[model samples]
Target: MMPLEPVVLSFGAVLLLGLGFGSGPCNIACLPYLGPVFVATGSGPRNAWRILLPFTAGRLTGYTLLGTGAGLLGLIVQEWIAAPWVRWLLGAATVVVALSLLWRRRHRGGGCVTDPASATPTRVAPPEIRMTNGVATGASPGATSGQAQALLPGGLFLMGAGMALNPCAPLTTVILAAATSGSASAGLLLGFGFGSGAVLVPTLVFALGVAHFGQQLTQHMNRWGSALEHASVGLLLLMGMGTALGWIAP
Candidate 1:
């Protein structure tokens, strides 16, 4: 019988990584752009089902592709590097990243770039704002809001793809390694299971009350969005530290 340890470990790693990163500060930073898609669908049972199906489908595709790619890479790494050393190196790097985040949080206010225009005391026009065609007028071109909604199925697909492209979770890396260490096919299948387990609940929830949740979050917590961002960062740092210290292990 095949030893189940590798597959089980990969599953746990992927699940933790997904949950940690998905709910962390980085996600909050991206929320302003992502929130509208959820909220635009309106919190109806039917609409919820509709939105979730496509989103999950997109996410599943993304995770599968990522796993495939990672599995291939893992095979290369296994040939080139010793496994224990690789794990330690990754563990160390993860800790360093976490430390950097904490350091930035601590010393964030030191560097300040003041506008020269402010010193010159020029009169500034009140920022003109308007609404037209059910969209905010005078909105900056770079602004993203409900923009994802505009793209609908395509946009959601891209979002899922992007999420997998550069997953920040340490566990994700570990899972990819574990999966690839064995059969690439096994790794890919495990990746699918991990992504499925992690994403299922949130996608379902978002589908159910996307619109209501969007409105409530935007209207009430917009100002506090930064707070959410910081909280997420803290969570990621904590998770990274826990893993590094072996308080939590794959």
Candidate 2:
């Protein structure tokens, strides 16, 4: 078992780090994916709590699994590989991931566009929408019922997973390495803390607006969301490049 103190402290640090870094960019880039989840859950107090629970649960599961895997991998590397090589390899990998993100951004139109009326918007309609309507009759614009059903719980989970899977920095790997070398339980606990920290603020904001936030809510969210996505991509690219050049360690 992991020592309770270190595990708790590590978890707390990871959580705070995630919150500090994740709030602006992840929140913005992921709004479209999340908005429907909120909307589907009915945008009320009870629904917000219900969705938040499962969403947080899934996130916790993902992070714990990731941390555990990283911890195990670190153990293997520690046994077989030199520490310098590991750092270099991690740095190289970070750079590659960052470059990929940059290339994607360049090709995919530089993150999401904030303005709805702008040449491009951050969120686009899914390709499947092109197919002829089958399950439900096509309703007039601004209709809620059919749209709501389309944004089911399963769909929300998948989206959340996708959003979280984006290439992140060495934070998780570093934390896992520390914990696994010490204790597996500590690593898992730290993972939960990081996940919770990353999610707390947005979840709170979402909870607060469960009932109503008027038209401004959507508009403001869209604008900020786009900006956040752009920032995240840029940060990732810069960090990746720095790591690649040996200017920073993983």
Candidate 3:
């Protein structure tokens, strides 16, 4: 049995490591993957969590799984992640995400608009709104329309998971510590702490900031929404291609 003190210290260290890196390096690393998706989704501050929660959960799951593997298989887990096939799979997945986004943008017509002549801004009511008993009511966008609503959370989850799988220095450090810990439970604990620390701050602050800013930007620049949307799609395509072709490091 390992000494409890060492394990506790190790866990704390790994968590602190995550916290230390999360504000700067983690944000930088994660933004490339998350920023475009968040912006293009056009979610407001009120609903941003709809996308963030699942994505954060996916990352936590990925970290836990990686840590467990490290503890169970020692260093062998590292080799598996480093394998070319893994990169290829992630790359393919990225390409698919890009394509899906492209399709959604094309199909989602009648975006927010404003009239220069009118005192009050008027735009197309979201498809999610309905008239019930002659009373205007809003419904869950995904309640009846299944796939479209599910796509954001589901894709974001995959993106989060894929991002976690990419070996960041903080994650690598945690994995190594967990591997040396020699207990799956210990690894899981360390992984959870680290994952929680890494995401708790940035996920809330950075994502919410982006969501708020993005919504404002979209509302103000409604006329250019389509162009911005196209640009986002283009960015996704480039990221997908780069990931697949090894132009971007995994």
Candidate 1 Cα errors over 4 Å, as ranges: 1-13, 16-30, 40-45, 75-151, 179-182, 214-250
Task: Give the Cα error of residue 227 in candidate 1, in Å.
Answer: 26
Q: Candidate 2 has what TM-score? A: 0.47
In model 2, which runs have C-alpha deviations exceeding 4 angstroms? 1-9, 39-42, 75-151, 173-182, 214-250
lDDT of 3: 0.65
**True lDDT of residue 229, candidate 2:** 40
Per-candidate TM-score against the hidden true structure: 0.45, 0.47, 0.81
How far residue 103's Cα lies from its native spot in candidate 1, in Å, is 44
What's the TM for model 1? 0.45
lDDT of 3 by residue, 1-250 (tens): 3332222337678778778877777677666666776556566667677668877887788888988887787677777777665556555655555666665554443333333223323332222122111121332322333344456567667767776777777787787778878889988988888888888777876557987776666556656666766677678778767876778874
When sorted by TM-score, best at the front, the candidate numbers are: 3, 2, 1
Stretches > 4 Å off in candidate 3? 1-9, 111-145
Worst 10 residues of 1 by lDDT: 123-132
Which scores higher on lDDT, 2 or 3?
3
Model 1 residue 41 CA deviation in Å: 4.6
Better of 1 and 2 by lDDT: 2
Note each model's CA RMSD in angstroms: 12.5, 11.3, 5.1
lDDT by residue (tens digit), candidate 1, 1-250: 2332343455666666666554553345334333443332222344454345654565676666556555666534323333343334333433443343334323322111122223322211101001112223433322243242243445344444434433444435645465545556756765676666656556644554454564444334433433443554455455445544545433
User: Residue-pair clashes per candidate, as listed?
Assistant: 5, 1, 0
